[model samples]
Target: MPVSRRTFLGGGLAAAAVAVTGTPLLAGCASDKKNSAAVNAAVKLPTYQKYGAIKPDLPGNDAVLDAFLKYPANPVKAITDKPGDGQPISFITNIPGAIPPAADNNQFWQAVNERLGSELQISMASNDEYPDKLATRIAGGDLPDIINIPPTTVQIPGLLKAKAMDLTEQLSGDGVLKYPFLANIPTVYWKGCVFNGAIYGVPVPRGMSRTTLPLYRADLLAAKGIKDPAPKNFEEFLALAQEMTAAKENKWAWTKPPLPYIRQMIGLPNQWKEEGGKFTSFYEAEGSSEALEAGRKMVEAGVVNPDTFSAKASARKQWFNGGIASFDIDSFVAWNQYYADNTAGDAFSVNMLDVPGFDGGQGKPWMGSALNNVTAFSKDSKHSVETLLKIANWMAAPFGTEEYLFRKYGLEGRHYTLNGTDPTPTKTGVVETGIGLQYISDSALALYWAGKPDVPQRQHAIQEKIADRLVYDASYGLYSETLSKDGARLTKQMTDLENEIMSGNKPVSDWAPAVKNWLSSGGEKIRGELQQAFTATSGK
Candidate 1:
């Protein structure tokens, strides 16, 4: 979750005041240049009290916003345009749900076309069928001028070999650096877009928070006489879950989707380190037993609904309508929707809990990619390199600004309204506007974007709270396509195995053999590839 300047000041004013006043003498003493530099460095560093609020020194600029607001009125001429009449630059995407016509209207295209003086057209494929279609298209050498690749389906190595065009030279060109927003993209994120020392695509970073955690009905927890409502670790969390389960007067203790997500909540690594610097399936991790044991404890304690394994998405309807479940784990984005839909005049409240780390185990939480997806240009596209650069430059703006924010979100009066200087729901919901609109096609990176000054201040406050409660694993940055392709398959297998074991179709003893098979079947190779990539790229 991201915050605006107002929210940061409002939330931390008391503490900020205390710090500033308490250190008045220190501030006065820092008159020398060296001392002032030290003071500035300290101020730029993140302080726990300001959790989720990016330090003011963190690079944030209005170039993207400026482009959105001023591009049409004063557009830059292309440094070099292709001679003669240009072909319609074909763009392809497989964003989920329907593509709004406004997104592809000539005015929007014109914003891009003006940068290169080329015709632009967009083609969309069904989201579910995109990967296969893209593969076929690429194999047939009939690629679009630009293609949006979903993170889930990108086979990085194969795509690089067949469809991706190296843009290293263009990315490093003087024109690219002249655009401040494009130039400011963090090198950490840019690393993902590079291969074999060459850049191929512009990375669209995802939000920072990734893992789901248990969100509890605070009112219910209080009613159950649960003291110290927040549990610090797995054992204490289990006890609380059991107590809540036993006291179910009108609600179940917990409910969850019948998926591996629950296992993941207990720190089940989808991929894990094996012997000799190789990777192994999650089942092979020393932590696997702890996760499985945790699962078994939940079932035995009856904290989890017996029907949970069979529960469908709608099974939680009772929980949603009647506040039946005391707690459940879900992605952070769902937290906002849950509160919006479930609140009862402030009687009910939601609190995200940090999924406790294992005992004596290193806490390694998953980190989602900053870019939800990547935008790639086809090798044969007619659009000049300058046009693509302009579009990318325009995309770097923070949401909630006069430019990109409204397009990604929506017009404030129409989609939302301010309530006493706070952005709150108008009749339209978050999905109808704001980050919700982007979720249909994008992964809602606006979660990390600054909020509007007038938006309900509570919205930003709650998001910061959620971010504070999240646990992050820096190792998640180690993911690579070389590992991901094999890793995805292994994860699917592990999920299936867990389901089978829980259903009594397989014995727990099967774990040892499964581990052996996983290691031998390309798992070790994937691990080695990831470790090597991480070491080379991250210097870790």
Candidate 2:
């Protein structure tokens, strides 16, 4: 399959293929028999210890995240000792967009190597290419010292057990306390890191910070004499789309079909919904059918851009950012970037749509797994686990620390300059630090927009408002052999069929047989396996 523009994906295929518009469900991956209750019980997770040096402007807790309006003045060092053993560490992570210049040419990379007192080598791949690239590497046994495991990839559990170093002894229970930064990751993110009854990786925690939402340009709407379009139902929502769109003006309600939002408004489950120990894949839900019809109607009405059915994520974002489109459904992570890109003096205030139900009242948001992905140390790694953990701890330093400032800004005067205590990246900084190092390991996710000071406060408030509303993925932290092995293939087939239906190339009736095929092929097995994982983890 070609790299798609789908920004969001639910596990493999849930919340109506939101992956195209937002992000992967951070979706759970494969599992094995080791998913037994006894195994899970014995494998104690890392202890939770929040890392805080500089208090945030809008303080947050476990549910809501801290938001900083400015970079804390004079960041203190998080790690006093060098973390590396001077052994060169090779890492692999997916760069969301452009692959950064290599270490040979990247001054920031060189500086990091200097600071760590070790040669740090990075191999970066685009998100679109990482799956296949990792597959080939895995097949050839040519793995990096630290490898990022994508959520949508299959057989990850088995692979981790076979090739990834088992970190259970090191990270489980109080052991993780040795690396304070790693321990800062919330317990929820680590739960999914367990597979085959062992902990193989450290989760890159994003938590609710990575959810997808329907966003609109409040300023753009205001320009059109529309103060607010807080539609109360699907009817009003559709009407607002039409109201905001004008073909002659090149304005559209959305650049891509807002099917993910529709799916959420229809009250669809994230990926799987469980009741009485029985699981129903979202693919077979009534809400899925409604989302399909609604999406089809949206496409047919011509309220969205002409490229709605096929544009890449970059194009859609350009459309939204340029005000050619007033609305877009994207991951919350995109919020800060969007503000940064809306540089012109033109009015701009990106706002979230209060997504309403199909009839009226509240809409449900399909919250992704707390984890974005996990990074594992390879069995082939020459460095000890403690050393690797130390290395990762250095990388996992929180935003308000000197390590973070240097890692992000680099050779201060050369790569970046301070703008009111915020690290404003120069052109050099942007190019050099673009290697997706964050994918290797990340501190607990937080809200901070350097140049855009007010963004953190506004975004934090928005997060707090919806803290209780998100419908978390029920399949989260569960193991499913079928889901792990066959999820990508089945999800592709399912989403492709959905696209065809929305594009008017296929009939709505086509959904039934396709669903039947999914069920027989692996969906039913996944259902059973998830229930098994759920029961085992619950000690039921």
Candidate 3:
């Protein structure tokens, strides 16, 4: 299959041929024998040490990320010397939008090399191409020192055992104290990184506060003398969508059907719901059919954007921002990204639609996995694990430290300029810096908007209101061989059926057969295997 370049804004597909949204259901480093969450949580993890050159304005725990309102005036140093050996280090990671300028010509890269005290190299692939590239590299016996494992990739358990270094001794228990930065990473993130009872990778941590939500144009509705169109139920939501859509005026209610939110409103499981010792995939949930019926009706009524099924994520975001759609589904981070992209003349507050209940009562939002990606090391790395660990520790330096300033923003004059207390990235900085490095290893997850002090508080407030209501997948930390073989086909089949039903090519009656096909094609086995794993982990 030909690969396409793609960027990430959080959830959803990386602009693939088919939209495979939501976080992947399997771990990149997993084991068939058992999941590590339960065992590892009881084992000695790194001591939970905390550090920040500057304290957060809005305090947060592991669930909520610490907030920073300004760049430190004089950032303090965390590492006294370079972490890298005097040799070259090569790694691979996904760069969302642009392939950064080459290291030879890239001043930002050169500066990072200077700070690390070694030549650093990266094989940056677009998100869509990463799985293929990684598999090829592993098969060819030409793996980079560091490999960023994306969740969507398959055959990871065997791959990690065969090729990835085991960091159990180096990172487990109090061993992680040697790398203070790594030690600072929350235990929850590390729990997801364990495989087969051993620590194999470091997580790019994510918070559970908010993952994906149905966002709306509050300003647009206000201008039309409308109240916040947070509907009371799915039925009311459809009416509100119809009320908001004016296709002749180049507006639609939303480009994509808010199926995830719909699932939430109708009280479906996060991904799997368990009852009476049986596990059920969201596809087999009670609300699954109802959500599909509602979706078809909306499509039939022309309330959905015509381009929804085919349009790229970027295009959909543009449509939403331009008032071509009054509501759309997006990652929580888009709240800040959209703000950053908006101009003074086009300023508007992006409001989240409360995940309304089916009966017009309270609703629940799904909490995604505690990580986006995990950074793993090659078992055959030329450098010692200790040396690599040191480099990772330096790279994982806390935000507001000098190491973070350099690694994140690059050289002061070249990559960024100070705007008030904000460290504004230069055009080169924006184009060059964010391409990959910060992802190789990250500091503690923080909520910081340099120039915009209010954003942190606002985001915190939103999270506080929603955190307790979030639901999680019962099979979150477990691995599934059945899912690996059959998930893609089944997911695509169901998604295609949805699009077909919505576009009137198929009727709602088609859903039962489609689901039956999914069940026959290993969905039932996946459910059983996940239940066994869940039982093993929960001791239920």
Candidate 4:
């Protein structure tokens, strides 16, 4: 339900924290057969066949992404033959931009379909509309061959169990070996796709700690002769924000509430934190109240956009990129996209802020969901399940391969051209590929940028620097019946209350009554169930 440069906005406040973590209720459900993630993981996962087509400039560990300093000069073919069966494959995707030209008139679509050996018809919707549309389509029994299930989907467990193909036998453990590309994906990412103890989909793998970062216009700051862009401590940060504030010039320090970043800076809990086997929600976590108060202070100080709560989501980026605002918070994935879009005459320096602590100590950031989203198949498809599996396999081809090229850039010469191995998209390619193709089934995380060879290294270095200061949710892989059923409503209540406090309409003390209501309204039940799940997984 979140839209930014990409689907995963990463660090949302309380609403996002609870909403993204909720799952479809599967307690004692026939569809899942009572399998837990631990049980599924115990099964033999597919052998991780490393793709050696193009070696990385920076070698990756499980926690890091493969960083490429330059595009492979001689790209190798990963898929030996066309994997798609000569049948039509229908899918639904959440496009972040305008829908591309229809397949009939689009050469890019035609070329991709020709290579896949199937008619890949994509039914597109905006990110905001995807959840409702998916639910409606599933309930109507008009399921597409493939559907992308983001983490934030409502009633995902039930939707997947009732309508999605149970991939336990096909993709569980060694089952995925049948499809070499899918097998190449790391086993850890598959854990996120598991529902009711069975592998249900393939995930777009991402690093655990790479998510939202406090972004600032380093170029703008440098122009003003500010060498040390980031503040040393929380107090200095406030002073710097006020200094950056220029209301009359219509320039401000931020475009949105900075509570999420501030929470990370003060070492606050990420949604849920554990202490002596009990999980504490963000509203009750240590330092959470202070974070809320900090946001209120910024709002009261007139350092951020006054209309931040009411501004359009798209306007946030426009304000930052146009220099109308000098600071904003965005996902780490936006680094390249922001650079590409914002650079015209004066190539600005868009830097990710290393969050500072209250007393100048290194701030701790919360770990992100290990994946962007999952790609699942329908139980009732026009084509055989095997055919769908092969299509997914082809789509999962790693970066620097021919399949990756077709999916990302479309046909060469027409859609894009190689400028010393960096494929520059033509106007046609940009327009046509706007609809999310790579997202349908992307391979493991890669830090490659053809145009900006140094981007991978820069980002990798930053992540490495902050690696130790990352905290994770205690109930990360656990499912709760209460959360599945009442999470949206509960999270929405907290989100509204938090916004009210930030806008100075209410005081931070009001959070206590909200938490009381949340507990009485199933939050207490969620805590107990999640605790049990944690114990089960940890074998404690």
Better of 2 and 3 by TM-score: 2
Candidate number with greatest lDDT: 2
Give the CA lDDT, 0 to 100, for residue 238 in model 2. Answer: 87
- Please tell me which model should have the higher TM-score, number 1 or number 4: 4
Please give the lDDT score at residue 519 for candidate 2.
Answer: 92
Task: Quote the positional error of residue 280 for candidate 3 in Å.
Answer: 1.4
Summarize candidate 3's per-residue lDDT along 400-513 as a digit string, tens digits.
888888887887788888887578777888777865876678875566665777667666766676666776665555566566545676788888888888777888888888
lDDT of 3: 0.71
TM-scores vs. true structure, each candidate: 0.66, 0.91, 0.89, 0.91
Ranking by lDDT: 2, 4, 3, 1
| C-alpha RMSD for every candidate | 14.3, 5.4, 6.0, 4.6
Candidate 4 lDDT tens digits, 1-540: 111111121111111223432443333222243544355335444556776667888886655567887767777777777767898888888888777889988888888888889989898889788777766676567778888877666545556677678777887656788888888887655666666556667666654435677778877877777764667787888888888889999989998878888998888777777666677887777787888999899899999899899889788888888898888887667776677567434557677777788678878776676666778888788777788888888888887787787788777898888888888888888898776776667787677666776568777776776666766665555666467557877888898998899999999999888888989888899888767765665521
- lDDT tens readout by residue for model 1, 471-506: 232223343433334545665676677756655567
Q: Global lDDT of each model? A: 0.46, 0.75, 0.71, 0.72
- Show pairs that collide, candidate 4: 24-157, 35-197, 44-173, 45-173, 46-173
Writing each residue's lDDT as its tens digit, candidate 2 over 389-458 gives 8888888898899998887678788889998788887877877787776877888767887777667777
